[model samples]
Every structure is written in structure tokens, then in C-alpha cells.
Target chain A: MRLKATNIEHFYGHEKILHGIDLEIEPSKITAIIGESGSGKTTLLAILSSLLKPTNGDVYYDDISENSIKDINAFRRKNIGFVFQFHYLIEYLTLKENIALGAFDEHNINTLMENLGIGHLANRYSNEVSGGERQRAAIARALVNKPSFVFADEPTGNLDTKNAVGVFELFKSFNDTTFVVATHDKKIIDYADVIIEMEDGVVKCISKKRV
Target chain B: MITPLKALRKNWFKTLLIFISMTVSISAIFLISAISSGVVGMYSTMLKTDGDIIVTQKGIADTFFSDINRSLEPKIINLAGVKELNSMIFGASPVDNLPIVAIYGVSANRLDNYKLISGIYPKNDEVLVGEKIYKMLNSPKKIKISKQEFKVSGVFKSKIGFEDGGVVMGLNDASKIFHKNASMMLISLEDIEAKDMVEKINNLSDDIEAKTTDNFIDNYNQFKIIKTSSDIISALAFLMGILGIISMMSMVVNDRKVEFGVMRSVGLSSTAIISRLIAEAIIISLFAYIAAIALSYIVLEVIQNIQKFQGYINGEITPQLAILVFVISIIMAIFGSLLPAIWASRIDPMSLILGGSK
Candidate 1:
């Protein structure tokens, strides 16, 4: 396991969202987390992405300490990437600038855009583009920082079947890094190397398949 | 640093409003400065164009009412550092219908300083009248002076306190007509130092005091303090204007909360965001200030040159006023932009990325 969580507990105000959760994430592999609504799938993803703090226990990033909120935030910034259902592109900037924004280096933006098949949409404003194009742009933006792990929460939740398959296949063909995605769609299940089913914030079953 | 040009392009209307506020603040300051300069300019012209020194009776607060003792005239002339001096008899009094006209008695040499617009300077026993005084004379062509009628010298003007409407005559003629002692003396310096001249005059005469022409003219009109007070009041008004602009800028930043979050996520530091906003404000304000100064100067100059104001208002716009307005505008821009920029820098990129409201 490259990233590990041990006895992690999380809460929002007085209500408990995660209880002594323990999980291991492998390197250079695609991991899928499946759960029903309100099953803590998104919450766990947020905590794993360092966007939320655990109430107790600890999370480690490849042996680096992420036990504190500051450490977790720094780790998220330098080593982790995130994508969501909304795309959330900056409306004022063009697609290319938005994608390059994550890298903090304008020089590498064009190359990343070309590689992601978004070179033609580089100058298009976020609001002017279609949902599929914006999602692709978001993926490009996430990958631009060259993070070791990419976390997605319902990335294709709002997309049609064709775009969803295309997005899953894009992640499936990524050879350079690992991915942890949460979803309910059965269409994407075939591409996962490992699938964990979550119910009521607990992992009820796990399955593995050969690709 | 986030380039301000990009921010201004993104938020054009907000930038424009900031620029407008800056313009108003700076213009208000410049207006006050111009009025002050005009007052000072009027006093300077009076001193330079009228007399070098003014002598009035000691213990008398009003120059127009001071009366000299004739027995001290020769002693004054023999004093060290003594210069050319002429006694003047001028005052105001009630007549049958209204206040009597202002009057002055001058020697031949002092007559050259008066610019007669329509008539000549007073002859040996005749009197010349101020334009305003001439109007009050009520006669069509000539007016009576003591016992003889003198044709009104062309209606004239002087940088001195000619606004009070006065008449002038030879000192001897005025003393004979008014039937009183001389009121004051106007002095012209040749090579005598002002301090030594005043000291000698003070020693020679018992009830006489000498003052620099600048001070004399300043005391003549009552508007000097008003000019300075207006400047202070306008400066305070500009400060309030800057504060108002700052609040408006805060609203602009508040409206762009999500955008700031995106910027932070994209590797923009807080410093960069603040710098960008300040730069945008400065650019907009500088442009507006320069344009406003140019417009005001042209308008003021044209107004000063109009027929009715040719002698009364000397256009006093100077480069110093423009420079002052420009600098104030820049300062106001930075002050207005600072807080919002700081807030923009504080936005968390993570909250924005994770489906949280900025």
C-alpha cells in the first residue's frame, strides 16, 4: 500500500460521518469505490483528498506525515489531484489558462492541452464550451500538476453515456499514475481493477478483476 | 504577480467606478488649490503692481482712517534710508443718500502705476475716479471735486484695492479739498533696505508705522483666511471620498468570491491578487486625473479671459496643481484597492474545488 489510513474517524459538528475507517490504496492502479446515496463515499473521498480533516487517527502519504490539517493540505497541493462532477472551470480564463493554472507554469500548459486533445479548445471560454469539453478540460487541469494520485467524486455523474465511457476509458488508459474514483454507474465498473462496495459508510464487500 | 491589466479587463465596470471616484476626489482638491492660488495671486499682483511699502498712523488699525501729523514730514525725509514718499488722503463717509466714495491722493510719480481704461490720471487740481466710483458720480461727463469741476479720467483699473471704488487727486489738491491732515503715505524703495527704512521712519515719526506692501494688500481684502480654510475643508472631503471608494471596491471583491478562489487554486498567491487590483486602480485613476486636469485648465482659462473678468480674475492654474491632483489620485487608488485585494488573497482554493461555496 502506497497510501494508508489507520483507524480514521471523522465528524461534522456533533454528527459522526466516518468511524474508525481503515483503508489501503495501492500505487499505479485504478480503484473504484461504489456506494449508495449518503453512504460516506464522497466524504471518504474528501478526506482522502485532504480536503477534510479526520476527527481522530491518521492518514499517511507514501510515508509522509498527513496527521495534521496543514500537512494534509500541503500534500494535497503538491502530490494529489481532484476532479468533480461540475467541472468548475474559471469562467474568466480560457480553457488552456484554466488547465495550466493547476501547474503554476505557463510554459507547460500548451503541451498538456495538445496531449489531452484540447488544443483546439484552448481559447474557448469555460461558459462557451459544452459539458463534455469542460470535463475533458478539468481532467487536463488535474493531470497538469503531475500528481501521483487523482481522486474523482462523481466525475461523470452529469455526463451522457458516450462522454462517460470516453472519460472512463481516458482514466483507464492513463499509464503514469493511480486513480481513486467514487461512482454508482455500472457502465464504468468494467474498467476498475478493484471495486469496494460501501453501504452506510462501511465497506460491505470487495471484488477484483483482471483487465 | 497577477497582472492588473487582466483584472481590469475582467472587471471593467468596477474599475471604471473606482476611476470616477478618484477623479472626483482629485478634482475637488485641485479646485481648492486653484482658489487658494488665485487669492495669493491677487495679493502678489497688488504688491508688485502698486507700492513697495505703506505708512499709516501709529495706533490706528485701519489704514484708510490713519491721520499723519504734518510737523513730522521733514524729519521723515531726513531719516537714514529715507526714500520717495507721498501722502494720501482717502476715506469713506456717509453722504445725503449713501456712503461717500473712496478717495486717494498721490504724487506725479505714483500716477504711472494706475492703468486708465477710459480717462487720464488726475491733473494738478483735478481728480480721477475708479470705474465703480465714476458710475456712482452720476454725472454724464464731469464731476465736482472741492471747488472745481474735473473731467473724469478714463475709467481705470489697478491691481491695488481698486474694487472699493475710489477717486485720486494730487496730494496738495486732496489736502485742500478734504480740509483735513494727510491720512497715509505710499513709499517706493530705491536702494534702501526694507528693515532699515522702516526702522528710520519709525524713529522719525511719533504716530506712524510702516508695513510691507504685501502685508498691506493682504489686510485690505478679507478673503485670505477663507481661501486657506476652503482648502482644508476640501482635503477632508477628498479623504472621505477615498474611504467611500474603498468600500465600493470591497463590494466588487465580495461579488467575485468564486473567481478569487479559482485564482488561488491556479497558483496565484495573495500578494499577486492584491498587487493586480492596486495596479488596475492606479492606471484607471491616473488616466482620469490627467484628463480632468486638462479639461479644468482649459475651462478655467477660457472663463478668465472673458470680457467681464479680464481684470478681476487672472487664470491661476499651474502645473503644481495638476501634479498634486495626479499624486492624490494614485494614493486614493491604492488605498481603495488594498482591503479587497487582501480578502481575495485569503480565499481557499480547496473549498472551491470540492463543491463548496466560496
Candidate 2:
């Protein structure tokens, strides 16, 4: 699935957070949005993922505009997943239960848990595990729905270098799902197939890595 | 995924607070209902008699204050369907250490109603004391009413609540003490003639009214006042209980805003989240209702043992009342959680994530 955003602009009250922006997210690739603080990278990612509606433009999934979709929540449920910087796993639920929150189908859950290397910790609460383990569970939750695209905002912002690399490696292994990650970390450039840098609410450069 | 259950388990203290508030509210309603039912039961038992019709002064709030001419008894007994007639006086006075003791003045023929448990029937100025009053007065040999001394002839028992805690004497002595001709008259009519007999008796005088036993009980002003008061108090208690549940649910939703945001971002719709919240509230209310039933029973038992409420209140919980309370509990649950659930559904996932990031 291809995600396209054209002439996108956003405002928080009277302050404009994002200017007119246009981008196309190619299918099945790691597209990283890298920028310093307050550059509106997170805002743009939110717009493309259907978490927030842009003030001036619309996002499209394979030529179907968001405005045309009758139920946006249903569309996101069937096609999109999310990972936040804080790994917002419900504290009361077990890791397995947290992952099941996003699953529309249950047959693949066990297999996915085992592949994530946290199968033995499935019954442990999110607070009972380490930060890296919790984030891994969050990633498992994102992919459990078998969505076409996974939007992550600073998913590894709280992890160490080793854990951050491991997270990117996990993202790289899922070749069928497009990943759009917004972060300021330079390490993501090594694994990203496409990198878009933003400064002060506008795109500074778009660079594609040669195969 | 049992998220609501898991959340309740994790926050056991909050769950307990909500449970207790709901239980108290339900119990208040149940207790009021039980007491009202008990009072009605006592009245029903007291009014039960072999007589088919009762005659009393019209427009009186209490039968104790009713005053009918004693000469009407002879005319009523001579009526076509009249089999027998008994005149009686009812009054209340403080005796010994007791306040407001019921006093019944009965004719000699009405002695059949009292089951003599200890001694013989009363005569002239003598009196028969009820079992409860006997115990309360420590088997007194004689008592004083209106500065007149009367010997205690015996101790008797009756199913009637007022009779069980009262003093019974000869009708003439009661008339002298109360300074009245008669309070009321009881008429025993031939089979299937009560309706015609009541009308004939009512026509005998303009100041007196005659009614069959059932009609008399139905129109009793005291019973109506008790029932209406109980209903009003129960309604207020139910409202307060619902408000308590709403406040508790609002707190729960406020504390879980971020969790709801996470759920929404993961593709759970707003309706699904609201359903979960309502489900939780219902579960809590159901458990509270069960607890309230048990609590009401315990309270009733304790009250039944008190000397003042002995025969007057049986403290029975009827099936109809229980079912009514159960239905009210479910309604309370839904209404209490609706506002909070709607508030939770309107939360913006993006704002939560962004706010948390900062």
C-alpha cells in the first residue's frame, strides 16, 4: 500500500506547526523522518497515519482519500498500526494481553510472540519487564493486526544503542510492512531506505539510498 | 480481553470504595422497604377478626380518636343480616416507665380473641395484660390508669401487634377512663350480607361510617402515610446512590485517559471503549446489590430483637421487593456510567500521545 500526503499544513490554535508539505511513502520500505525538536516531524507522521487530520490537506491510501472513507477508525483498524516513544502498554494488562489489543485475528499471536524473543514473558505485566522488552512488546502489538503500514514516533528514543539497533533490525526483518518512523537519532540513517530531514516545519532534504 | 476486570483487580482500593458506596445506597432503600412492609404486616394482623364489618366516626385520621354513640350498637345488632355486634374503645396512655402504651377496651364476648397464657379473663375493673407488657412490667399485680387502680387478672397473648404490647380491660371501665360513649363497633354479619349490612349501618347515623374489613384497611390514613413516606425516602436514597456511582466512574475515567488513548490508537473504537466501561459499572452494581441484600437481612434481624419492634415488625424481605431492587440496581448502573463513558470516548488520541511525550 502507498501512502501519499499533498500540501499538508497544521496548526495548534493560532501557531502553525506544519507548513504545506507533500510526500509519497513507497510500499514495503523503511522511511525515516529525521529532524531536531519542534520541526513538526511528529505532527506530519500523525497526519499521514490518520491519527490527526491536517488543517489544509488530506492523506490518501492508494488513491483513496481519507475524506472519502466513511469510517476512519475502521480504516485504521484494518490497515494501520502505531508505536509511540513511551511504549504505551497498559500497565494492568499482561504483555500478551496488551499485544492482543490490536489483533483482529488471534491464530498468529503465539507465533509472533515467539519471534519477538519475549514469548516466555507473555504473562508478565508491562511494568514487570525492562524498557527494551516493553518496547518489543509494543512492536509486537503494532504488527499483530497485520496492518499494511506501521507508524512509529521516536520508537527507540528511550533505548540504549544496542537496543536501538536491535529495534531497527526487527523493523528491517518485516519486509512486507512499510515502516514510517519519526526520530532525531542519526543511527536510523544506516538502515533506512529513504530518509527525509525537516527543519523548522519544512522539508530540508529528501535522500534515497542506492541499492 | 478482560481489561475492565483486570483494571478493577489492579486497583482494588478504588473498587472497594465504589462497592461500599453503592452497597450503602442499595441497603438504605432495602431497609426502608422492609420496615414499611413490616408496619403494614402488623396492621394487617391487628385488623384481622371474625367480624365482617367495622363502624367508626367518619373523617378521622386514627381509629383511636373515633367516637360513635354507644346506642348505635343495639340498632346495628337488630339489623336483618346482623348476627352479632361488639363495641370497643381504643386509647393510648403512658403507664409506668413506658411511653404511649396501647389500651384496648373490649366487651366480655370479645374475650375469645385473647389467648389466656397465664390467668383468667378480666371482669369489671380488672385487666388482662399482654405477654410483652407483662414481661416489661415484671408481672405487676395491679396497675393504674387515669388514677384508678385495676388488678391484673392474667397474662394473655395475641397475634395482633398492638394487642401484644397493650393492656385490655372491660369496655365500661375503658369508657369511664377515656370519657367517651364508644370509639367503634365490630359487626358479624350472616354469610354474603356484609355489603348490604354496611350500607344499612351507615344510614343509621350521619356522624358514623360503616365499611367492610378490607375497605377499612385499604382506606386507613396511617398506612397510606407510612407507605408514601417510605417511597419518598427510598427514591431519595436511590438518587444519592446513583450520584455516588457517577462520581466514582468519573474518577476512574479521568485516571485512565491515557490508557483509553492507547486503546483508541490501536484501533479500538469509541463505542467499544464505552461498552467496556458500562460493563464494569454493571458488574460493580450487581455485586453491591447482593451485598446489600445480605446487609439488610442482618440489620433486620438486629432490629427484630429489640423490645419496641418485637411483634410490630417481622422484618420480612418479600420476593417482589427483592426483584424491584434488582431492577433498580441495573438501571442505576447504566445511568451512573453513561456520562463518564461519553467523556472518555471523546478523548483525542493524538493529544494524549503528544501531551505524554512532553
Q: Each model's DockQ?
A: 0.27, 0.71
Looking at candidate 2 chain A, the ten consecutive residues that score lowest on lDDT are: A101-110
In candidate 1, residue B144 scores what lDDT?
60
User: On residues A1-211, what C-alpha lDDT tens digit does candidate 1 reach at each position?
Assistant: 2788888777767887677778888788888899888777877887777666678877788766576435343455467777877788877778987786647456877877777677889999988988888998988887877788888888898899998988888887777678999899988888888887888767777787864
Candidate 2 docking category? medium
Please name the candidate that would achieve the greatest DockQ relative to the true structure: 2
Q: What local distance difference test score does each model get? A: 0.70, 0.87
Clashing pairs in 1: B58-B207, B118-B154, B119-B153, B119-B154, B120-B154
Candidate 2: the clashing residue pairs are: none
lDDT of 2 by residue, B1-358 (tens): 3777888887687788888988998999999988887788776666657578888998888888998888887787788888878888989877767766788898888877889998899999899988888888888999887778889999998766668888999999999989887788888878766888888888999999999988888888888998899999999988998899889888988888888888788888889888888888888899999999999999988876678653556567899999999999888888888889888877778966596542
TM-score against native, each model: 0.73, 0.92
